[model samples]
Target: MRRYLLQDTAQGIFFVTISNLTKEDSGKYWCAVSTKLSIGNLFDEVSLTVVDDKTLATMFISAC
Candidate 1:
């Protein structure tokens, strides 16, 4: 089984949180919506990249 946390609001704002993220989760994610105020559907995509602890350490070290 898989678990996910979703945060949303009355406004058109939304968020998806994945705890204990894994490399398999790295990909393009999008939110698609349709409302009475709009004649057509709208969608936006976001990129999520998950890195391993070693990669994170390397990034911080290289940035220094």
Candidate 2:
């Protein structure tokens, strides 16, 4: 699982980014803050859906 912690100083935005999305990656995700001693709790769960698509031309090309 790839996780990211990025802060945009220009926009003043705080959020996390997930990369390398896959079908199994589709699930409930959330964010939390914590210290080195202990982990934080879960809050504001969000659902993510990943769709896999193939074009007809690509499919036909591969079949050839």
Candidate 3:
């Protein structure tokens, strides 16, 4: 399976896709933007949680 894919929406918007998510995939991820030599790089981080179908359903139910 394709693990990673980077896409540009043709409108200055970008997306990153990770396929076949698993428990191992749950971790911190970073999105980096490079700037000109005069400026440093920009980075944003997000935490991901990979849960099974049952767990996801339970979470949804509990939220209601």
TM-score for each predicted model, relative to the true structure: 0.64, 0.45, 0.66
Compared with the true structure, all predictions reach lDDT values of 0.54, 0.44, 0.57
lDDT of 3: 0.57
lDDT (0-100) at residue 26 of candidate 3?
79
lDDT of 3 by residue, 1-64 (tens): 5566777665645766666677877778776767675767866776778885212211101110
Clashes of 1: 0
Off by over 4 Å in 1: 53-64
Instruction: Give one digit per residue, the lDDT tens place, for model 2 in 1-64.
Output: 4244455444423545555556776777654443354544434556767685221110001110
Model 2 C-alpha RMSD to native: 13.8
Best by TM-score: 3
lDDT of 2 at 15: 47
Sort the candidates on TM-score, descending order: 3, 1, 2
Give, for candidate 2, the lowest lDDT window spanning 10 residues. Answer: 55-64
Off by over 4 Å in 2: 1-5, 8-12, 33-42, 53-64
Worst window of 10 by summed lDDT in candidate 3 = 55-64
TM-score-best of 1 and 2: 1
